[model samples]
Target: MPTAHAPGTTPITGVTIDAVLAGRLVRPLFQPIVDLSTRTVVGVEALARGPAGSALEFPDRLFAAAGAAGRLGELDMLCFERALEGAMAAPVAPPLLFANGEPAVMDQPLSPRLMELFASRPSFRAILEYTERALPSVPGSLLRLAGQIQLGGNGVALDDVGVDPMSLAFLPVLEPEVIKLDMSLLRDPHATHSRTVCAVVRGEARRTGALVIAEGIETEDDLVTAREMGAQWGQGWLFGRPGPLDGAGHRYDRAAAAAVRASRPGFHQPDGTPFEVASARAPRLPGTAEGIAAALDRVRHIAASDDAAVVVASTDDLPVSLYELAGQARSTIVLDRPVPGEFAVAVIGPGYGHAVCFRSTGGPELVMVDDLPTVAAVSRVLLNRHTRG
Candidate 1:
């Protein structure tokens, strides 16, 4: 077994990236995710470290070196394998193991060895956690990977949420089993931004029954604040630091455990246009293209001031205003589809969902949906098409 390194150890230089990957110098550390109500460890997040006393010991440096060498995917897979191996070797395995995955490599096929490792431990439950950093460029990829992970009887989590306002718009699209609040929210729970994030997260959790885990809880006060913010589970120094899995066992919270095991249904479908899928669930309102366009324009104006808003529109209509919306909204996607006299727009955010789909052939009628799930479905459909095109 590789010895775990303490922080601030003497840094050794000249460790080549090849040596690190070939030698498998990465070490796995487990930090417990405690059930705040029961104070029991429900899960452990796997953290990767580099060789002891080496400059690459820090994850940022290790990953940076790998990225610079154009081997980030390989390094990411290595870290994942090490984390699983460490968990399997532990004397008292956690009920849940949360592993970090880089979005850039999430679409790649899993290694045979890793697949076998997972098969070998059929009883072990793993939840793959990713961030929103890659959503704008690769929503389709992330959605596909998430579907694959859940289909394999594992779970998915959105990590470090609240750091990006746009993440709020993706809540329904991914439908993560666990939503890990970013550490910054806990550091200043009373901040206006923090409160807004908490309210949105709490509402989503209630609607979908997703488990909320607060990160960076180092004191009793932080724990209290986390509960008030509707976090059922938490991770940080107060529970345990990232280290070997020894002395980390605790009773499981049955309800929380069940929630972790119960995977939500997939949102993205293989077939159907954005309008076809979303309109099926929502009511189509009778209106002219001009009226629908006017309503969408109003939505665009409102979304411009909202930090969490995401706006997507077809370029056939409203070409100039789309540029202005792009500058003010958290995320803006302009789809270039030539359907004369057709107009479509979707605006979604934390607590809001609105979409306008107009078809000229159908006597200038349109489908308008305000339901969150339908709106998210519309956004996903458009995003998938954009990615494929």
Candidate 2:
């Protein structure tokens, strides 16, 4: 069990984790991401930092080793167990925990061993991460698992967004409770190709009714940059480094959560022109499930419109998920659930559905479409509008 093995020495791949895992060598370090407005410690992202002499020191190496060893399942579960255990002791525990599980694992259905882990630890809150993942095409089972997990009360988060449009397209479909920006791609001003990437992500956040977490925040500039762009919560060394959460004082060294309050996110890019930041908007979806039906009529077409996502979301001042198909009325697929609010579109299908809720201007409207095509279609409308315009 070690964190630092001699480099280029016995190369412990994924299979090697077994030798490592057997002796108890996992240390789940936690970094706190404070809310910009409340300034409260809302959530802690559980990072699996290895032991003193383990090869699991760098996450890339650790995971690469796991993959090579075909011990992905074992690695995923062990980290899950350690982090879940760690969270129970975390003082200001956020109801949510961001653990790095990929969509593929969620797709394959947990192995018997992993199922036992979940059964034994039902209280652990996990958000699957897109980092260290090679964007596997998610299938229907993962969607079912998401619905099942949300119903169980502990939820899923779409972690490390800002990687691809595919992830953003899937946001509403998965309807994660938390969506963390891949921090690396998030604040670096997007690419020179276009600025709509940020707007797309923000619109998804606005529409899906989920929390948008910006990760990889290293300095004040990164923190200010993300918050101004409308991230609900933030992670990274800028706010706090990976350390002992309990022994952690009220603040994180010099770069504290308070900075989110002190710094304002800039709408203007480094070049000074206004970056096309997604305008923040409260949802206007209908109130009751019955009302959700009516609400979709007015906006499902809007969801299908040629307007840019930022424009549509800002105009409605609402975020939504599709629930109805042909309804020409304004009703929301609103549910009796306690979900963190963000933006997405869904259409209600004939199942005991959990809604992707939005805070809308006309009231809140929820759409519930139980498939990826429907969700991706809506996201495309948003992306295409801006690109075409």
Candidate 3:
């Protein structure tokens, strides 16, 4: 068990990359990527750390030594392999595994060995993250390489976007699927300069349909700032620090457990009475725009008298239009793949707070108004299940 180092620890010196590699002590820790809207661990970012108590224990020091020794490629490969191994062994399946790749290696032709590694794990959706500082001086090759990566079915994320002038320059060219904002952007989200830069990144990301992730969040205010800046996903100590895969999985497990509890009968209620939870009994709708709109039309008709209804759609069957509608309506949306053939959608209102249940599949998908908080709690459980699945 390694003693977690303080965030303020100074970068250690004197570590030799060769010695670190010879020891084979480069281990991978996973930091959870949380979906702020759902409060779930949607993915994990693999961070490589050296052995505990060693000079190379700090990743910055280890990588610095590797760079000094001109063995950065070797170090990165080691980290990449170890990250895959550890992530696969985690208790909970992460939707995405984020790994760092250096430009020096990525600029060259793709490695057969790396491709084989990816091929071996068909279930893992890996995203290769490249920092702005590491971007190849020859931007063309990097962009071409990024295209190749996507062709191979993996995703690309630009780390620390807006951190450097180079990042801003390459934003349009790379057009990564995920844009990780530099933590500094949130130092003062409202500041004129910060706001301007953030808007630029946000605009480009939105234009490209890229997901924005705010990094280095350490406060509730920071989280809020990140949200205001249009970050759909977030990673930082406030969520959880980088730790062993099992540990990160445990954190996710805890969250899922809480979500399940929140969805259960007595969870938010003080009196310990039970509310009817219904499932969808109707035919499965195709997970298409028209299908979802049709289903939603039924819901809208049922809730015509109320404000809105909580909709739990199949995570595996989620339609882009449905997602957009949920976003527009500000409705409680759960996107879990393994949701049973039918689930529940509830409406709560004026007098009582507990929501009446509706079968997901059948004609009675709408329920009477109940307690608002209870309905919300149930929706969370369904959403949590989606995260876990």
For each of the candidates, the C-alpha root-mean-square deviation to the true structure, in angstroms, is: 3.6, 14.0, 17.3
What TM-score does each of the candidates earn? 0.88, 0.57, 0.59
- lDDT tens digits, residue span 1-389, model 1: 33345666765668877899999889998888888988987878999988877778878889998999989988898998998998888876777889999877666778776788877854467898988786666676677767767766788899888999888888877778889899999888899989988998999888887889999999999999999988988988998788888655655554445657475446554456666766698766676656765767767676876857878776565434666654477887766543366566788888788887776666656787888878777777766655531
Give the Cα error of residue 31 in candidate 2, in Å: 1.0
Top-lDDT structure, candidate number: 1
**Alpha-carbon local distance difference test for all models:** 0.78, 0.50, 0.60
List candidate 3 segments past 4 Å from native: 1-16, 109-113, 250-389
The candidate, 1 or 3, that scores higher on TM-score is 1
Higher-ranked by TM-score: 1 or 2: 1
* Runs with alpha carbons beyond 4 Å of true place in candidate 1: 1-13, 246-256, 314-321, 325-327, 335-343, 360-364
Q: How many residue pairs in model 3 have overlapping backbones?
A: 17
Write the residue-wise lDDT of candidate 2 on 1-389 in tens digits. 44456456664545357766786467788888777655566667788866534456667777787788877666776776677767766665444556776544544455565455557654435554544142223333344445545444456666666565445445554555566777656556656421455676576555556567777777777777777667877777766788666776544223332222211111001111011111112233345656655544544554333222211121122324333231332222221212233343333211111223344435444444323334333333322222111
Overlapping backbone residue pairs in candidate 2 total 71
* Candidate maximizing TM-score: 1
Please give, for residues 300-379, the per-residue lDDT of candidate 3 as tens digits. Answer: 44445333233444343333344443332223434434445443443332222233333345442334333343444444
| Worst window of 10 by summed lDDT in candidate 2 | 267-276
As a whole number from 0 to 100, the lDDT of residue 307 in candidate 1 is: 59
Q: After superposition, how far is residue 381 of candidate 3 from its true place, in Å?
A: 48
Candidates ranked by lDDT: 1, 3, 2
